[model samples]
Target: MTKGRRRTTRDADHESFDTAYDAIMARWPDGTESLTVPTPYGPTRVHACGPRGAPPLVLLPGGGATSAGWYALAAELSKTHRVFAVDLVGDAGHSAPDPQRPVRSVGDLTAWLDALLDGLSIGLPSGPPVDLCGHSYGAWIALHYALHAPTRVRRTVLLDPTGCFAGFRASYLLRALPMLLRPSARRVRRFLEWETAGGAPLDPALLRLQERAAVLPAVRPVTGPRPDPAALRGLRCPVLLLLAGDGRAHDPHRVAARASAVLPEVTATVLPGVSHHVLPYAMHADVHGRTAAFLGPLSRPSR
Candidate 1:
């Protein structure tokens, strides 16, 4: 009976999470399509939109933010580029994790990304390199992938990325401890409230989805040391590093200084009045303008 009850509770948590996710997705622009691309890790869920022949721009959301969280930004980028917003493997969204092939390390994570890109038919031989953009933890993944396969990526964008250039603020880690140690809806909400303090109000639907994320069965995310500074200096692709001026996660100025100094080709900017968790969403207009400017005009239709 105990086992059965546990199973039932897990099922309910998944249901609630989907309901909230769907609610948020319902607001996405017209013609948006959700498809699953199979990878060795699992079937990755991607929300695709924009013209089919346009250059692909992949968006990776922060941890627990889900692909649906990119709705607003996706809509903007989709106008000029095909947008593929992904639900990361082993996370709380629609993507399923292969228990047998768990992503155990940063190496595994990069391999999973390679398979995912191949499944999507991106990169050399057939298709041109795609632009990669990510936020927070997702930004970490994007940076690592760019380093792993520079030839496969045309450009990269990192939005308030953590653990890439600077260490996390000790106070920020302390506040996240409760949610990390004993995750609950209340704890998740509390964490967001504290971190996003002084930022514009967040979308209610997005908040609901995040709260439900706490109860969903999720795999432990891969964690590792910061990328080597030597590797940063070696990266060749154009990069846009956008920091949240009010972010409590780390010193935005310090991040800017380090990134500008190490990266061979980088454009770093700080968007004031927004915090880490509320970014891209909070500074929608500013983020879109800078991103589109950096990405330049859309690609010509594939021959």
Candidate 2:
């Protein structure tokens, strides 16, 4: 007879987040390949797509997200630019594990990005610099990277970015509390299924893939200190803030207003009828067109 499987607290927690992640991944599917870049910390795996000759645009996903999160947007953007959709080093999806040292602060995350880009040999030629587009927590990382390495970035876009507001709101905390408290796979899967189907219907195959990737064991656990807004004043790149029309947790318009006031070179736009999670779908075309127009004139020919 087969022995019964053991269930422990750690095991339960692991299964929860794993299941949730798998569900989310099931909804967003792509055939992009991966690359491993050797860094002082370790080898970082980056998932990418797009034609090799096109201008480079790096896409970063939200918290607990993978490069696949950019599926809808990258597909459109890649038509005109080489899109490098990266799995945030320590979070979910296919990024290599961090070194024995802990990634505890905003600076550490920025350094990790620098090492990854340097190792990948991106942004050296033409002196044009790389464009960064990040959603949610990834936006925070993008902004921090721009601040840390101003010369390396040509332009930056923050899509429904989190942590840009003065503080995390109560509703956000309430929603996040469940994930923090249980962090279970089943719960996450339910959330993914809901999110995938909750918005305007998406492709069925993409939804299935998102569900599978969400439950993988390799997804990183959430940790580390919160970011400080004081960090925003340090960023010196041309910034674009895209606010979702139906943003509820933090007022997107308010955030955009504040960001525009504080960020030296900034532009803000609100996409009507788009929810935070569904902004990519609603704004993908507009973003792609606008980005191509913005970056085309800026990229310099290699001398």
Top TM-score: which candidate number? 1
Clashing pairs in 1: none
lDDT of 1 by residue, 17-57 (tens): 88999998887889999999999999999989999988888
List model 2 lDDT by residue over 1-303, tens digit each. Answer: 237967776565556545554554444435556677777555666766777767778988877656765666777777777778787666665566656854667767777788887776777654457889988788878877787777788788888888765455576566656655655545555554444343344444434444444445443433344344566666667788887666554777788788876787787887665566556544355565665565555444422
Q: How many residue pairs clash in each candidate?
A: 0, 27
Question: Which parts of model 1 are misplaced by more than 4 Å?
Answer: 1-7, 298-303
lDDT of each: 0.88, 0.66
Task: Give the range where candidate 2 is weakest over 10 consecutive residues by summed lDDT.
Answer: 219-228
Residue 60's lDDT in candidate 1 = 90
> What is the clash count of model 1?
0
**Candidate 2 Cα lDDT to native:** 0.66
